[model samples]
Target: MLDLLEADRAFVAENEAQILDLEAQITARQRWIDLLRDAQRAAKQRLSSYKYPVLTLPNEILGEIFMHFLPPYPDPPPLVGNLSPICLTHVCRRWRDVACKTPSLWRAIELHPSVHRLSNLGETLSLIAKWSARSGHSPLSIRMECRRQFDPISIFTSLIPHRARWEHLNLNFGSGSYIQTLDIDRPMPLLRSLTLTVWDAVGTPLPLLEVPLLRTVVINDQGSPSLVLPWSQLTSLTLRRTHPGACLSILREASQLLECRLHLWSQRTPLGGGAVVLPRLESLVFERDSEVCREFFESLVTPALRRLELPEAFLRPHDVETLKAYISKSGCTLQSLRVTALASLIQQILYRMAFRSIPTITFCE
Candidate 1:
């Protein structure tokens, strides 16, 4: 009986040992299974990130995408709107970091300061300062239009500090009060395009000879004599609300002009001078003055002229003959002609036949 009992005990002990060994093996396998599951989850996360590139795109790549979101540089987006770069800051934290660090995004600014509203001026100035700060050392394109009310000096004061970066600047004011406050006497190294317009002429002339890089200019009647431009260097010029004499005088100096647009204030061609010969002039647009622009038309000799726009009245008493003579004199192969028609059907037909050699001709009444 004792031997049988001892055998039973030995058998039980062996079975217990086997059970413990099995438990140890099971625990090891379970640990490996858990580790594999953790690794699989991490890999899945990586795959999802790859699928959505914005999630994993480096900040530099994201910044480039942000740049495409705004208008091209030198053309400003609104200071505050969906189109504004400021909208990018409202996104995730990472995106905000990327946008704030991109200088080009904040380089252009457009401001309209209403004199009627005294309240918004402060806010506008704040935004201008903010953009200036965010732009870093990048060149600036600034446009400001102030209507009716005087004194937008504060706005000018804000921008005067960054004059070195003025690339494409356009300033329009209701009166000339703002012109004196414009501290543009300092050199604008990067200034390429400039537009300055005001209603009443001020004694203070805006001498902009310091802008060596200036190529394009647009100014009004008040701006004509008041602003001294680097006329010879200009490639494109637009003069609005100017006298015939003044217009001719400017054209005489702008010898390098490839394109010119003149909106004459009167038909009186006061001075009898030689034709304002522009050898390189390619396009000429003469917006009708109060009277006929016949004399003005007779004044230009552009050999390189390809496009001409003027009133039919400007072609004068002998329209076809005048145009034929003008074309002959210019030695220009006019590719396009646009005429503001105020002529009878017979006259129009004759004009059409006369200019049939021109590749494109359009008439608008």
Candidate 2:
């Protein structure tokens, strides 16, 4: 009887030990499950934060912000896709969507090929076409500059088809062989302002650029036979490094011209002996290369001229006296005079002008 009792006791002890081991295993598993659930909740919260936040901005505010990223009109600044994409798009999806939809934000298309490659020419043109189409009949101002090798004829031809949509055209051909190959015969009926910098003297005679609404014309080269200025409505004229003889002819034709800028280089020819009567002229700018500025100044006969900008060069006492005498005699309404020269010569000129009580003079050294 005692052996049986001992055997029962041993069996009970073993069973209890087995049950406790099972309970510990169950507890460890429950702990693991709790840890897994906490991890899963944290992951869900992180994913939710990553989801795009809703932006509640008015359309006009969004438009204005996008406009800040846009290029100025009448002349589109260069676009590198860096600012609009990387800077703005990275902020949020709403910003990306707004940037993508703002047509004016993308309307500025720059064709200056120096910053882009020839392979990109097609892409650039396509971009311009897209922007013009998106502008919805709004007049476009196109600035095309080619400083390296390019097909000027091809470029001009491509733009000719869109001439009716062009409001302002700025062409800079600084260093390129193709500059001479441009075909300017195509008329830009809607062109209001034209700026041309021709490095090469090639191109067919420009057709009558008879934009009756044209107001400003800037030609920065010796007058070329290929270029025929439509001067009937020209109000502002700027001639930089131009042939003196041709410029005189242009001035004579632009009888109603109001503002004039003449930047004469050393190699430019002196104006011929003639009296140019600019009856309505108000401002005259003379940026000279040497003392020969006197010759260029003497060529003009502007009775109503009010401003004079002299060159930065050493002038003898006699030369200063001569300039003062000339201004005293002709420029009765000369209100402002800006003289630029070396320090010593400028002081001497100022002293002479002051002694004569010539109208206010500003010296630039």
Candidate 3:
């Protein structure tokens, strides 16, 4: 029995020695495997450097290139797809880091119902939230075009939180009801330009009183009476499809206007007030489907006016006399005059001959 036990013990010792030797081999092989991995990684990186030279450019240059990749400032790029800045993040880790770090690339946002599907509203809103966050604290240029079916408030809600940074805001809604819900009454110190267009009449007034930097304004049709702006600060103004009465009302406060364009639609309302003298007015354009009222042209007093454009009918009863009297009344040196004539060639020739003293005179039939 003792001899048998000794044989078994010898067998156990041999098995234990073989297992230790195999374990030692594994440890040494693992070290070799680790070294090979490091070598593979370094070789791959060197090969990648030669294959993709653009990756070798400094991040600053790359970031600058990204800036040009977008549309000019105040003009926003697409929200998604290849043309969008968001696509830059999908290329690789390096690019994602660079794009997210560049705040200007994400400063402007466009939420158009035509550009995005209604089903993706949630997704688009999420993307906008992320986009705005990436913009840091940069002043934002936001353009939102909403149709009747699409609730602008969903997208606008995301924007209201960032209103303080709003530099340029353009809101075009098919329904005026959307405008009433857009609680943009808060102070926006950086706001400079505003363009508002609404198809339906707005009952509520959209007050933008805190915009100290606002200089440009464009209101379309029914939106004219709905906005309460600091008109005295405006340098450029465009009113489309607005009545002459409304235009006169707005002009009363816009004493500093340098350029003005009015597309008159209705003249039923009387021009009850006296003349509005725009001391700094330089360019004036009046457009109407029909002839404008004589009083409409005569109501404006622009001493500094250099360029005047209007329909020949506005000077009815006596064209030459009215033109001469208007020039004398304004005391403005006319550099250029443009008239849309519907009268006979003889009448046009009369204007050309009578206004020979003017530098340039153009007639459009």
Ranking by TM-score: 1, 3, 2
Error of 2 at 278 (Å): 2.2
- Decreasing lDDT order of the candidates: 3, 1, 2
> Ten-residue segment with the worst summed lDDT in candidate 2?
175-184
lDDT of 3 by residue, 77-138 (tens): 99876888988999999999999999999999988856755356778678888989999999
- Which numbered prediction scores highest in lDDT against the true structure? 3
Give the top-scoring candidate (TM-score): 1
For model 1, the run of ten residues with the poorest summed lDDT: 112-121
Better of 1 and 2 by TM-score: 1
What C-alpha lDDT does candidate 1 achieve relative to the native structure?
0.84
Candidate 2 lDDT (Cα, 0 to 1)? 0.66
Task: Assess each prediction's global lDDT (C-alpha) against the native.
Answer: 0.84, 0.66, 0.86
Residues 86-165 of candidate 2 have per-residue lDDT tens digits of 25656777776676666666555567665654355576567556556655666767777764455555665676666776
Winner on lDDT between 1 and 2 is: 1
Q: Which ten contiguous residues of candidate 3 have the minimum total lDDT?
A: 113-122
